[model samples]
Target: MVEYALMLAIIVGIGWLIYNQTQLSDKINSVFNNAGNLMNDAASKSAKPPTT
Candidate 1:
């Protein structure tokens, strides 16, 4: 009985950890995508030919 309880607790803890990690990964991906877009925009603007 105690073993069953311990197993349940461990499973719950692992699930929570997985959930948290997935959320964190999503946030990191969003930040990276935004940074990439900003960098691309800056590069394109700098590459434009300057008019007199």
Candidate 2:
């Protein structure tokens, strides 16, 4: 009975840790994507032919 409870606790703790890590990775990915898009936009704008 005690072994079962300990196993359950360990499983729950591992699942929570995995969830938090995934969330953090997603947030970091979003930030990098936004930064990359901004850089691309700036580069494209600078490369456009100037209008008379």
Candidate 3:
């Protein structure tokens, strides 16, 4: 009855939280990955000797 409904609601809320967290983590990972790649490219370019 009411208990069943409560349990269902709880389960749904937990599932939503997990789904949201996963999406957020994926976005964070991509941002950091892009930043790391950009930094690496800059570093490599700077290490080379200047050309006339």
Candidate 4:
């Protein structure tokens, strides 16, 4: 009985960690995408010819 309880606790902990990581992963992906967009915009502006 004790062994079974320990196994259950370990499984639950792993599941909770995975769920939290999934949420965090989404946030991290958003940050990276926003950074990429900003970089692209800067590059495009710099590539244009300057107006006299």
Candidate topping TM-score: 4
- Alpha-carbon lDDT of model 2: 0.95
| Each model's backbone clash number | 0, 0, 0, 0
lDDT of each: 0.95, 0.95, 0.95, 0.95
TM-score of each: 0.58, 0.56, 0.58, 0.59
Provide the global lDDT of candidate 4 against the true structure.
0.95
Q: Over the stretch 1-52, how does candidate 4's per-residue lDDT look in tens digits?
A: 9999999999999988987978977888999999999999999999999999
Tens-digit lDDT track of model 3 for 3-52: 99999999999988997978977888999999999999999999999999
> Which candidate do you rate higher for TM-score, 1 or 2?
1
- After superposing all C-alphas onto the true structure, candidate 3 shows an RMSD in angstroms of 7.1
Q: What is the Cα-based TM-score of model 4?
A: 0.59
Candidate 1 structure, TM-score to reference:
0.58
Tens-digit lDDT string for candidate 1 (1-52): 9999999999999988987978977888999999999999999999999989
